[model samples]
Target: MSEANKDLMEKYMKEVALRRKYHEQLVELKGNIRVLCRVKPVLKEDQQEEGQAVVVTTDPNNESALSVINKGKARAFELDKVFHPQATQEEVFQEIGPLVTSCIDGYHVCIFAYGQTGSGKTYTMEGSVENPGINQRALKHLFNEIEERKDMWSYTVNVSSVEIYNELLRDLLSKDGEKLDIKINPDGTGQLHVPGLRVTEVKGFQHIKKVLAKARRNRITFGTKMNQHSSRSHALLCITVHGTDLANGSKTTGKLNLVDLAGSERVWKSGAEGERLKEAQNINRSLLALGDVIQALRGNQTHIPFRNSRLTYLLQDSLGKGNKTAMVVQVSALESNVGETLCSLKFAQKVCRVELGPAHVTISFRMTRDAMPYKTSQR
Candidate 1:
């Protein structure tokens, strides 16, 4: 490499390192849990007139303030950040990019999308091919960080995907589609594990692409009056990063959990019945359980109800103390969705108050089973 190019690269790496350090300190000072709000534009299928009123409004001067109309009353909510409907996928990811890359530094991170049916939760978490969302962007960011630090660090990334449908856990990457169970670590680590779940060692972006495509194909989705392609299951993509410092012979492990939760639905509005009704019921129950857990955490309760549902059970580690977490609440701006949007915003307001404490970096020589959390699968 030319001397000039080498100098430029060194300068860039220094900048990245400095920025990362600053973000780490900032996040620590603010606590671990962050809540961001995103407002999605009305689509053609919404069937609203061209000049129809928008019930949700954002303050141009204050990016963190969101207001919505409910029963002719204006209610305002404050979050960590707010994204307008015109915001691009790249813009959304930029804010959380540090959280995604922090896994390399051995900080556990969890990012999930939550909202009512057809509120663009899935789109925000897993966007279209041309404008890939957080899941794709996070993987790429991690890979790039690995490459940039290859001189001093050796990293291994393991990927796993699962779906909780009807209160049952199914391995998304397993060919058998078998039901999986979460087992507490026998070593007294107090960590949860999923036996026989497929874990793939990812080396490059191509491997990530194939795994994500397969996961999306395996996820369950169905049509409803509110949404034609409503996701009926909560999907989690777990990326575990194992890093070894060559200089000191020390090791560290971190996990980045990318979750796309099934949107909460209103039964009367969605017109759900039969099997669809069952799925909706399960989804609502799980989401309610998650909210309960959050409430318990915020209040510093004696017991956290993680075992109440499959979704919360699987995410116990990430949502617990000493880990960084972020939630993106997507809401519709249409007047018709005002009621549901209010519910979503109120839930997000509650989420903003939950503090999970400062995050810590894991440094150890022994490889923890919970780091991988699943069985290695043959590709």
Candidate 2:
């Protein structure tokens, strides 16, 4: 082999070593779905006149347990991880950083935020511009990793953002508010495709930051009794990474889905009317469907109901039998919202019990022959 070819082969070998290292680390971290609970601090304005009494507290004995006090009774719930109101955005991301990195090693990953209105779901997923939250941190880490591996592998990253409002899918990146159609690919990959969605090829963190800003502006939000600017739809941000081994003829495709579900709320509590009422009902309906899917998965049912909701349908691949998933359940600590907090925690508990089969890497290799240089077979 020529000098250039020899150098390329050495680089490829190094890439293979790095990939194997990541793969072994991922295997150690793989398991059933994980659930994390985060408690939001009670704002001064929301505090009772006499400090009626704080209703939520973390267990001193167990860091992963939360104590919820109501009417002189205390109940404890356990989770994979629990973040107190004082936890910083950086602290929260530290726990999930490994799962995010696994995507680069060819594993599908889905991270979702679930909670009641006025809870900390949005805050945890998308914090202030100065202290960006999980989505931003994950993207930055992913880009940095890509840069480090640029010498051995070439990567193409594309991003697509969409929102589900009133059971309809709208492209958050598009200028017009047009409903998009979703199709299930019949190629046996069990992937859902949004035909008209505008996916942008992102070069780096700055490019993705601009796309995120545009999507946030286009997302549907409205005022509610609990939150002034409550999200009226479930917004999903998808990052598709396609990597090619430069020296060896191999390819890998991985996807990371960051979802911010609209807060689950009661219609009467929110005092919804007209459009708001419709939005609330739809949101609740989709959440209910999600609950059903989780229940079925937990029971190890032969047929999982991914088709019950648009959100579930679109996420069939990621939530199915062989992917890594994590959920951050946000809760409010105010006494007034105790009931809703309990409900959110219960749902999270169920989510924690659902078992997704062992995670697998989605990578394929190509064989080169003297006669057929371009032929490839997926393994």
Candidate 3:
């Protein structure tokens, strides 16, 4: 590159950095914890159901509010954002693109989809190849963001996938489907770490796609009365970004967690039995524990109950202080699902009120890497 070209690139980078700083200010003004509601489209099967009626409606005047007609009375709920039935996957990703990119700047960010069975949580988190969802879009965005900053910083992206089933943590990227355990870092950082979990270092979006595909194959799903191929476990995709400033050699680590929670459905409705019954019980219990933790956080309690469940405990770092978190509560518009939809919206409303404080960039002088027992390819 010519000296003149180098100077021009440097000037452009400075401008980009300044613009990002202003954008961060705007995001901070919005809040650290965001709660979004997405009303899943009424599918053909939902239409075929005898009792299926349109009970949920979006407020045209208020994009942030939704109304549900339950017990012949309409109740309105407000959230940080609301996606109507016609909203496309691209539209949903656009709303969260900024949050995804924030991880490149060393912020711990987590976005999870929560809802009842077959309410489209998985679809929203992992859309079809024709229209990829947040997980794919977020990683691709990070790749572009990193490439733009390559002259100023060098980064390594590590990916890990885990499933929480029956209150047990399992490595979703492992061939043997190994059960895992969470422990505090021995170095006294008070950070949680999962032992025996698989972490893959991806050079770019293609590598991430392969990693996600393998994890998806290993995730547990089952046929239930509520829906076919229902997720039996909470699937969590954790992406950690490690960057070293080229100018100063200072290092920073940021993490982005994309979680697809297991369906929060009633046992009687799902007709769960035997092993399925056990799974449903655990899933509901863990979700309840999560709600309790959120309630404690909203009340500013001294104890947050992070250890009440494995799902909550594993997400301690991301859910606790100085982290950006968002929840996309997926709901169905079918009247048959009105009760579950109401429950999901109410939960989202509660989550919206919990202030997680401002997220800080994590920088450290220590240079360390996790021991890799699995395959990790880099460019």
The best candidate by TM-score is 3
> Taking the tens digit of each residue's C-alpha lDDT, what string does model 2 give over 33-144?
6788999987887675657567889866676899898888998888778899899999999977887777776778889899886787778888889998999999999999
The CA lDDT of each predicted structure is 0.82, 0.80, 0.83
Per-model TM against the reference: 0.83, 0.84, 0.85
Per model, state how many residue pairs clash: 0, 0, 0
Better of 2 and 3 by lDDT: 3
RMSD after Cα superposition, model 1: 13.6
| Reference-based lDDT, residue 124, model 3 | 93
How displaced is residue 316 in candidate 1, in Å? Answer: 1.1
- Alpha-carbon shift of residue 143 in model 1 (angstroms): 0.3
lDDT of 3 by residue, 1-379 (tens): 8999889978877886798798788677776777888999887777776656799999888989999999899999988899999999999998888887778888888888999878888889999989889999999999999998898889999999987878878787888678888988898888888877789999999989999998887664322322434376788999999999886698888899999998887775657688778777888889888777766665567898989899989988777766777789999998878899998988888766555443232112122122444434541
Where in model 3 is the C-alpha error above 4 Å?
1-17, 220-230, 268-274, 298-301, 354-379
Candidate 1 segments whose C-alpha is farther than 4 A from its true place: 1-22, 48-50, 220-230, 268-274, 299-302, 354-379
- What's model 3's TM-score? 0.85
TM-score for candidate 1, residues paired by index: 0.83
Instruction: Order candidates by TM-score, high to low.
Output: 3, 2, 1
